[model samples]
Target: MIIPVDQLNPDTLNQVIREFLMRQGEDWGLAEGHLDDAIQQARDALVQGNLVLYWDENEESLTILSKEEVNQSGLG
Candidate 1:
């Protein structure tokens, strides 16, 4: 399911982004202090409609994905 960014609590959204960034840290070579920047970039993408928030009911999990990815996967 597609999750609307405006429908989520700000704190919850930030936490989710934080977790996702932590997982991506290796690939991003993200330093501890640089997390905020990364988060902002992710948030910007979300606001710009370049990224999406997805909720998978079966897995009971949420994931952040690119708009193209969602379209390609037929999840949107």
Candidate 2:
């Protein structure tokens, strides 16, 4: 199911984004500053509709994914 980012509370939104970024490999590097930048980018994408929040029923998990990922996954 699609979830609007606005539906999440501020704290929950922050935690969800943080967890996703942490698992995103080395793309954002290890520096605190760079991590912030990466997080901002993701936030921008979400606001711009380039990325979206999804709730996967089977896994009972929430995830952030690119529009392409949603389309390719046949879930869009």
Please tell me which predicted candidate would have the highest lDDT against the true structure.
1
What is the TM-score of each predicted model, taking all chains together?
0.89, 0.85
Tens-digit lDDT string for candidate 2 (1-76):
8898899997898788788888883765635547777877778888888989899999999988889999999887
Residue pairs of candidate 2 with colliding backbone atoms: none
Models, CA RMSD each: 1.5, 1.8
Report the lDDT of model 2 for residue 55: 95
Model 1 TM-score on a 0 to 1 scale: 0.89
Model 2 is weakest, by summed lDDT over 10 consecutive residues, at: 25-34
Measured with C-alpha atoms, the lDDT of residue 56 in candidate 1 is 91
**Which parts of model 2 are misplaced by more than 4 Å?**
29-33
lDDT against the true structure, per candidate, is 0.87, 0.83
Q: Top TM-score: which candidate number?
A: 1
- Candidate 1 per-residue lDDT over residues 11-60, each given as its tens digit: 99999888888887864448656888888999998989898999999999
